[model samples]
Target: MNKLSCILLTLLAWLQYSLWLGKNGIYDFINIYNTTKLYENINDITQMRFRNNQLLYEIYDLLHGYEAVEERSRYNLGMIKIDETFYQIKL
Candidate 1:
């Protein structure tokens, strides 16, 4: 009877260990969830970096190029070249 009780306790301990530290353990699930969140944050930062690069390129062009300035002036001030004619087609 004593041996049987000892074997039963040992088996219960092994089962508890397997439940907590096996392939699909709670700790493994938590680690995977944390890694997923970190990757999502990295993706968001990459997108923001791309947007910032595009805006920087636009700023550089506007600062250094006559075409950019001409476009801005044409749109903002209704400007035209000396030999150009203006026609307003209103809807």
Candidate 2:
């Protein structure tokens, strides 16, 4: 009876170990979950980098292009060129 009980306990322990920590086990599931999170973070960083690049290009255009500067000046500061006649139409 004692030997039978000991053998059964050993088998149970081995079975539990194989189920939870073996080749295809709970550890694998956790690793897959972590990997999915890493992929999502990488994608988010890539999107942010793309947005940053677009903003930088816009800044460069505003600094170097006369049309962009003129548009901003006309819209924000109500600026007119020296050669242009200023007209104020009253609503």
The local lDDT score (0 to 100) that residue 21 gets in candidate 1 is 81
Q: C-alpha displacement of 58 in model 1, angstroms? A: 1.0
What's each prediction's TM-score? 0.52, 0.46
Off by over 4 Å in 2: 1-43, 86-91
Q: Pick out the ten consecutive residues of candidate 1 with the lowest summed lDDT.
A: 18-27
Model 2 over residues 1-91: C-alpha lDDT tens digits?
A: 9999999999999999988998888888899999999999888988988999999998999988989889988999999898999889999
> Clashing pairs in model 1?
none
Top-TM-score candidate index: 1
